[model samples]
Target: MSLLAVSNLAKRYRRGGKPFAAVDDISFEIGPAETLALAGPSGSGKSTIAKLVLRLIEPDAGRIDFEGGDFLALSGAALRTRRARLQMVFQDPLAAFNPRATVARVLDDPLRIYNIASRAERPRRIAALLERVGLDTSLAARAIHEISGGQRQRVAIARAIATRPSLIVLDEAVSALDVSVRGQILELLLDLQRQERIAYLFISHDLGVIRAVAHRVVILDAGRIAESGDARAVIADPQSAVGKALVAATPKLVRTSQDAS
Candidate 1:
């Protein structure tokens, strides 16, 4: 069975009394340990798709089935418990974390709430998580303001993994960092996937980033799927006009050759 399957999913809103579909009737499936990227230009509803799967917003129609069970069927207490198995790492880490809280406190909350580790063992786990995201455990007690943008992003990734989720929505998670740091974080995420076999829905506008990390690519255009296939194949040969535009818009794959200087 697929890890996740979305069938005929749709979400909409009204603008000036006109109904607009932010996400149309879209369907896709992801398998275990797979990295599937949803790529598109702005206003294409890729992020809206992410929100639907994560249940940040309810879909107006269709179904989200995870492991053959209906996700939308669960709510309130049941939904809260199911959340531990599916987590999201957002686009901006600085915005994601509370400025007032120490990194340790933020990361520790998931551990405590999920009951993943006892209070006594949380220290060791926090240290391990920091190391996994390429940060020193000593930085755990530091405020979000004290770290580089990259380090702050790592903290968010660490928090997401500390729950040991089966699926992670990396919604433009690496786009905010410096190019060099972005590469490192992508590598770290890949390493973790290898170690834990975590499935990722990596949403990004950067084809370079998508090509580097994704196994399969799902291209969205105007709130609908224009293309979906192997990342290498899709990057090399885009079937749709929108897909071609996305590839052409990239800046000469500078992200890959930036290291040669």
Candidate 2:
């Protein structure tokens, strides 16, 4: 079974007398240890799809199944607890964290909130999580202001993985970092995914990074699925209008990796 499944997801915002669809009839899945990249321009409904599956917003219609449980069917504490198996790495790390909290405290918050580990176990897990995301544990006691943009992003990613989530939705997670740092974080994420058998729903505009990781690619346009298939094939020879645009916008000298093990 797919580790994460989103079927016919639809979401809309009502303004004036008409409604505007943010995500329309989108369906896809991310398999165990697979990276699926959703690429689209701003307002193309890419992030909206992330919010829907993550339960950050209620879907107007659709089914999001994670490990045989339909998340759309869950509610209240059950929903929250069930959803903890999935985590999100936001586009802006600084915005995701509470500035008042130190790095260690920020990483520990979710463990406590989810009751995943005892208070005594929180510190060790927090430190390990920080290290997993390529941060030094000695920096744990420092506040958010004490870190660089890249480091803050690492902390944000560490917090997401702290609970050992099976599926992680990285919504433009590396876009805000410098190129070198972004590559390092991307590699770190891929290494973790390999180690943990994690599924990644990576949303981004940078096709280069997507090429580095994604096994499958979904292209969205005006809130609709434009094209999707094997990452290399679809991105190489696009057949739709939106797909053509994505192909054009993609970097010409893209690096290709083949390890279909």
Candidate 3:
């Protein structure tokens, strides 16, 4: 069974006193240890779908099932409890964290909030989380402001996995980083999925990143599904106008492991 299943999800919003659909009748699923990419232009409903699945915003219609449970129907403590298994990494990693907080403190908050470890054991857990993200524990003493953009993103990723979530919603997680750092982050994500067997719903406008990481691809355009299939097949032979345009517009250079450093 799919780890997450979303069906007929819809959301509407008021703009200039007129109602418009931001996400309309969109549906998709993520399998165990799978990466599904939601790609589209700036205004397409990509992020809206992410928020809807995460329950950050309530959908106007449809159902969200995670591991056979009704995610949309959950509320209060139940919702909070379910969130422990669902985590997110945002587009801007630095913006996701408090500037004044040290790396240790940032990682500690989720552990404490989830009660993943005892007060005395959190320090060790923090160090381990940092290590898994390719960061050394010494950097734990540094504040978010003191770290490089790449390191800040690493901390963001570390925090997401702290609770050992079943799935992660990475909303343009590597977009802000330059080409090199972006490559490393993608590799790190792939490695983490192998190690932890966690599923990912990767949201991005960059086709290159999606091609590199996603097993399946779902192209969204104007608040709807434009095309979806195996990542390689969709990229090679785009069926939709938006998909064709995206593939044509994408630069030919495929990022490599050497570019990571």
- The runs of at least 3 residues in candidate 3 whose Cα sits more than 4 Å from the true structure, single-residue gaps closed, are 253-261
- Name the runs in model 2 displaced over 4 angstroms: 15-17, 251-261
Cα error of candidate 2 at position 122, Å: 2.1
For residues 24-108, could you state the per-residue lDDT of candidate 2 as single tens digits? 8999988899999999888999889888888888988888898778778889999878777899998787788888789988988
Candidate 1 vs candidate 2: the lDDT winner is: 1
Best by lDDT: 3
Q: lDDT (CA) for every model shown?
A: 0.91, 0.87, 0.93
lDDT of 1 by residue, 1-261 (tens): 799999999999998999999989899999998999999999999899999999999999999998568999998888878888898999888788888789999999999998899999999999999998889989988998888888888899899998888899999998888999998999999998999999999999999899989999999998999999999999999999999999888887357646853
lDDT comparing candidate 1 with the true structure: 0.91
lDDT of 3 by residue, 1-261 (tens): 999999999999999999999999998989999999999998799999999999989999999999889998899998888999999999887788889999999999999988899999999999999999999999999999999999999999999999999999999999999889998999999999999999999999999889889999999998999999999899989999999999999977667655742
Task: Kindly indicate the candidate among 2 and 3 with the higher lDDT.
Answer: 3
Against the hidden reference, what TM-scores do the models get?
0.95, 0.93, 0.96
Q: Which is superior by lDDT, 1 or 3?
A: 3
In the predicted model 1, the residue pairs found to clash are: none
- What clash count does candidate 2 reach? 0
Better of 1 and 3 by TM-score: 3
